[model samples]
Target: MTARVPDAPPHRRQGFGAFVRARAANGALVVQPRMGFSDPGHMRAGLTATRAARAHTVGTVTLDSYTRVGDLDAVEPALRAGTPLNGYPIVTHPGATTRAVLDGVAGPDFPVQVRHGSSLPQHIFRRLIDLGLDATEGGPVSYCLPYGRTPLASSIAAWQECTELFSHARDLGAEPHLETFGGCMLGQLCPPSQLVAISVLEALFFRAHGCRSISVSYAQQTHPGQDTAAVFALRRLCAALLPDVDWHVVVYAYMGAYPVTEAGAYRVLREAAELAVRTGSERLIVKTVAESRRIPTVEENVAALEYAARAATDNTTTARDPGTDSQTYAEAQALVEAVLNLHSDLSRALVMAFERGYLDIPYCVHPDNRGLTRSRLDEEGRLCWAETGALPLGRLVHTGRRREVTAAGLLADLSYLRRKMDREAIGAPPGTELTGSA
Candidate 1:
């Protein structure tokens, strides 16, 4: 039996997606922080601070690890023992208490999103629905593969049910918005084309499951030019494929290794903001100076938010167009077409694509992943696929006798940006040459 969705006031409040769209229409980028606390007072304070920052901002309630993994039993003990969880345990917290945390903080102007890394988010979705929140971010494939050993089939089934459950927010006169984490697959080392393809596919999946408002995500990659091209590709594909759905593009700060130095981290974040502005992305998820060392404090998050806002203001005045004819767009379009041709349903096609190696993630070791594709950074610091495996790119990829990646070479590639930025933080020349598989 299907459980009934709870009733709430028909409050006509503008959701997170609408708020971002309005900001984008006015030439401002919405900056958000990934912050949550085990204590409600602290969470409330953090939200208040984020909303009051000197920038266009949104609020985030990132869930703790125990809630993410579905181990609700561990939550009570941790709370009682006064041990700090990494984020807010939403499912374990009382609904009224959570409401109190967001009181006067989350509204039409300052919208909030609940970000939980849960493959099976039925309970989390219920909590959000009960709390009258209408925005969340995650996808079955993206949340499952990188986080744990959850089977892809099970994750997909869970997400289908959860997506339908969350879509009922419209009944209460609020538009629910979902953001796909697919583009950040494996976070780094995966090439841009596949990332773009996955993000579009997940947005399609959400639409199929009754979500009308959605956001596509892309993480900052090795090269700035490539990243710009990738965002353009994402926007183009979303425009072509999802004409009926209300969608926007979101750029995530480099999700890979972070520079150890404060200056280096801030520089990378500033670059991300500039990328968002140049690509006409509506929103940016930011990282702080303490990203490499620890979970940042509320003050650090505010600082990062303000800095990104300033960067966006400075860069958005002059926009640059990454042409649709770029290599990234061509490759991404081909991948999207190949997956869509597999089946009428996007979710089924995604699973089959993985099984047949039609879609592959580089350096991903999940059981569902084929592990056939490999990627390396080129001389110009662009991520290039060294081995394309069975992806239906035809002549789009040209590796020409792939060479094995050494342990040292892999380490160097992983630390490429971190080392380069750290060196530039002091007085050192920029390193352009990267360690390639060849």
Candidate 2:
């Protein structure tokens, strides 16, 4: 037991899963992957593996923006082509009021591609309403788009775009939706006001836009010494505005991850689950493991979720008085103070990073988006385009610093984590105890 496993390879070599499991238990690493939101796509041979993950709850199934109905014809090719998170629902944009976006998984068919910089008739609203008649499977329906570039106007505009569509959907009896990687949703370079503004915007946007369903997201990432307080604030806000709207949280599982590496993602998992419970929303989306490093087979995706579900713990198990049930207000305040003190030390370092230029965001829209168009190669042997090739944003964030999360970095991560941890946003934390039945 003292010695390393005989044939352990370098990555798995440092120790075995047993070693990592021990570290995670000590609070050194956040174990138990929680609130997974995944978009599974790979070569033709990867379909069966995708279906296998039906066990874990999946919140968001990101898609290839260009995928259309015609692409699903080939069996092997179609498998490789992509599948829908739910059956691909028809999305429509009528008048200037509609801004349709595609997020979630593949297997889609759009009525027609709308060209940018092209003129459109105002009467398009009727066509859009007609198109959306049967788009949803009658469960719940919503919309999404890349968080646009430009700091001020764009962020607000993106928010407005959702409002318009949500209003349109309401006119026709459907809920409204909005989603994006956290950082991009707020402006990558904007101040905290912009970040805080996102929630406020969603609250107002959904109401004025006539939508009842609302969602917010953060990048799937964290650093050492996570700012648990900042995470708490974000969650509290969701609880404040959204007792009714749906909340979704997604965790990205990939290789070389920090939180996953240091704490094993369970720390964040519990946080997200806590938020979900506080918000009291019904469904939550969780991500799949085996996604950070390589193109996962469907089996690997399911295995990752199963592993997280099997290992996750519940952190909000404190006893509640039977007579006095709702302490939502008190709970919200407590979360804020808790996050502040917890992240006091960590926020400083990130502030410094912000002051300096170490963290420049090159990609404007979909900054942390990890959806790859397809797992393919191009001329001269290169991994698809650089954007699609290397680790995507979710992959990068989930893989936090290899070093321990300093109190400073923790603040930065917690800011995002707070938004990420809401239970409605993510989901209930998976059971911490092992199932013995994978």
Candidate 3:
């Protein structure tokens, strides 16, 4: 049975998607941080601080690990023992408590999103929608492949149900927004073309399941040039496919290994902001300098947000149109078309795509993943397919010069950005490899 959002005043505030759209219209990039605390007071304080930041910002209630896995029973024990969970335990906490957390903090100008890495999010969706909150992010494929062992078929079904339930928020005059994590599969190592393809495909899946407003995400990767082209392809494809849907592009700071140096961290973050600005992405998810060490304090998150905002402001290069003829665009479009041809039902098509290896994530160990595909960093630091497996790209991807990724090569590639940024931090000359452990 489908749960419904409780009654509310008509048009009480701006919707999440509407907020982002308005901010983007005014040429201000909306920046957000991935922050959550177990205690309601701490969570509220975090949101309040994020709201008070100098940049145009949004709020995030990232759920605790236990809640994300649907382990509600475990969350109760943690709460009772006063053990601080990694994130907010939305399900375990009473609705009134959550309301208290959001009250005054989330409003027309500052909207909040519930971000949980869950394959089964129906309960989370029901809780958020009931509280009059309308934005959250995840997708059947994106949440499943990277995070857990949940069968792909089950995840697809659960998301289909949740998407339909989330769509009901529009009836309350708020356009519920859903963002795809597909572009950030396994955090790193996957090629950009596949990332773009999965991002678009997941958006299509959401749209087909009843979500009207969406955001497609692309994570910062090995090469800025390739990342730029990937976001361009994502936008162009979304334009062509989702003409009637309200959509935008969001860029995540490099999701792989982080630089241990504060300067290195800031350098990566600044580049992410510049990438967002140069590509005309509407939003950015910022990471902090302490990312290499520990969960950042609220102050660190605020600093990162402000730093990213300043970076965006200083980048004078406006977004230029990346025409649809680029290699990334062609490959992504082909992958989308190939998958869509598999079955009329997007969910079934997704299952069949994986079953037949039409879609595969590199280095993802999920049982649903084919594990046949492999990717390597090229001499220019661009991600290339070392082994194409069964992807239907058929010469669309040139793997000729790419060598198989060795164990040592993979380790170095993972730390490629970390070493490069740490090198630049101390004004070390380019190509001078940083010595000693990461």
Q: Among these predicted structures, which one has the highest lDDT?
A: 3
Model 2: how far residue 114 lies from native, Å: 18
lDDT of 3 by residue, 1-438 (tens): 001123334665678877887888888889999999999999999999999999999999999999999999899988999999999999889999999999988987899999999999988988887788889998999999889899999999999999998886676557888999999998899999999999999999999988888999999998988998898888889888887788888999999998878888899999999999988899999999888878989999999999999999999496566777788998899899999999999999999999999999989999989999998888899988899999999978778765767999999889998888888887778777654323
TM-score of 3: 0.95
Query: How accurate locally is residue 68 in candidate 1, as Cα lDDT from 0 to 100?
Result: 96
User: Could you estimate the TM-score for every candidate?
Assistant: 0.94, 0.39, 0.95
Candidate 2 per-residue lDDT, tens place, 106-133, comes to 1111111111110111222234345442
lDDT of each: 0.88, 0.29, 0.89
Decreasing lDDT order of the candidates: 3, 1, 2
Give the C-alpha miss distance for residue 313 in model 2, angstroms: 5.9
Better of 1 and 3 by lDDT: 3
Error of 1 at 261 (Å): 1.0
Each model's backbone clash number: 0, 54, 0
Task: Please list the residue runs of candidate 1 whose C-alpha ends up more than 4 Å from where it truly belongs after superposition.
Answer: 1-11, 317-320, 429-438
lDDT of model 1 at position 192: 97
lDDT of 2 at 76: 32
Which segments of model 2 are wrong by more than 4 Å?
1-60, 65-162, 170-174, 180-197, 218-227, 239-285, 312-438
> What is the per-residue lDDT of model 1 for residues 1-438, given as tens digits with 9 covering 90 to 100?
001122324676677777888888888899999998999999999999999999999999999999999999999999999999999999998988998998888888898999999988888998888888899999988998888988998899999998999996685457899999999998899999999999999999998999888999999988999998899888888887887777888999999998877778888998999999888889999999888878999999999999999998887543555657788898999998998999998778889989989888888889999989988999989999889989999998899887788888888899888877776765456664322111
Better TM-score candidate (1, 2): 1
Segments in model 3 whose C-alpha atoms lie over 4 Å from true places:
1-12, 429-438
